[model samples]
Target: MHVIIFSWEYPPRVVGQLAEYVRLLAAELVKNRVDVHVVTYHDFLTGAVEEPDGVKVFRVANPVRTHVGILTWALTLNQEVERAAASIYYQVGKQVALVDVHDWHFIPAAVTLKNAFGLPFAYSVESLEDHRAPPANTPYSMSIKSIEWLGFYEAQRVCVKSEWMRDEIVRIHAVPKGKITVVKPKANSWIRDILAMYKSMAGGAGKN
Candidate 1:
């Protein structure tokens, strides 16, 4: 099965756990012999299309020149996502079975991909209610809520990390309970090995 993943960030440009999660999931999917393609922001350094962990990673340039605010950035990200997804469709020429969007930040991108290819898409709500939380009077918050609502309506499945998030989206956002699935996040074993190696190196240096 061909799966296209959309995330705002991915390694080696780690912003948060989302990037790590994407990396881990992609690796697992690759291990299972699934053809996976990831579309994300261009790496600031290489700017080259490369396969990381057996998954094809495509990076697109962010078009927005200035970071006016969160809302503007979100809108621009969506625009870039649409452009990237279209490019992927044209180049790949194979319809994706599923498009997995990481978080609310990638909702616009996911929606664009879904619309452009008419493919089934799933959403992963990494940070729940953070966008809707207090100082909610801002235009950015409203825009986020609107985008999230659209995503909720469009996605075939709403995947979340915890039951709290699933419940919140169902309760506050009025998303159907049946539409939500709670899948707990698992730490990547490769990352654990890397951390252990770093710790060992630090210990050896300390002994020296």
Candidate 2:
């Protein structure tokens, strides 16, 4: 099956541990014969490249260079992200099976793709604004929370690293327990569990 992964960071763009985590997951998926494509952000680099391990990486840069906060920055960059992902969709003959979003940064783009192209997406919950920010009810934090809520509501599935995170998501977003799956990345069953998640969603709706 073919899949697209959305992340804000990748190799040579490490802002946090999620970058390496996604890198390893994509590589594992490739080893199992899955067509893995990653769409991510870069300051100056803007294009696609095939990695040595057979993963296709598409890097997009934010067109507007200035922003007041993460919200504006992410919102502006999503246009570019959506453009790149759409290009991949048509370039691959519209065979993209699933989109795995690593965090909240790209939820808008993913949701747009889902609505416009019938592509199913999964939200890989790495962190949450409710947990990250000191005051969660601020307008800015609420905006982020709203995006998280939208993602959970739209995704075919929600994958978390632990039971704690799954519980957290349920508590924060009111997401149904059945909609969330606890799959620890790189564990013994990591590949098997993740493959099952992908296969399950891959057979769902997509552009016809």
* Per-residue lDDT of candidate 1, residues 50-117 (tens digit): 57578888776666668878677767867767766666666656545667888777787777666665
For model 2, the stretches where C-alpha displacement exceeds 4 angstroms are: none
Lowest lDDT sum, 10 consecutive residues, model 1, at 199-208
Residue pairs clashing in model 1 are none
Which parts of model 1 are misplaced by more than 4 Å? 43-48, 130-132, 187-208
In candidate 1 the C-alpha lDDT for residue 167 amounts to: 84
For candidate 2, report its TM-score: 0.97
RMSD of 2: 1.0
Candidate 1 global TM-score:
0.81
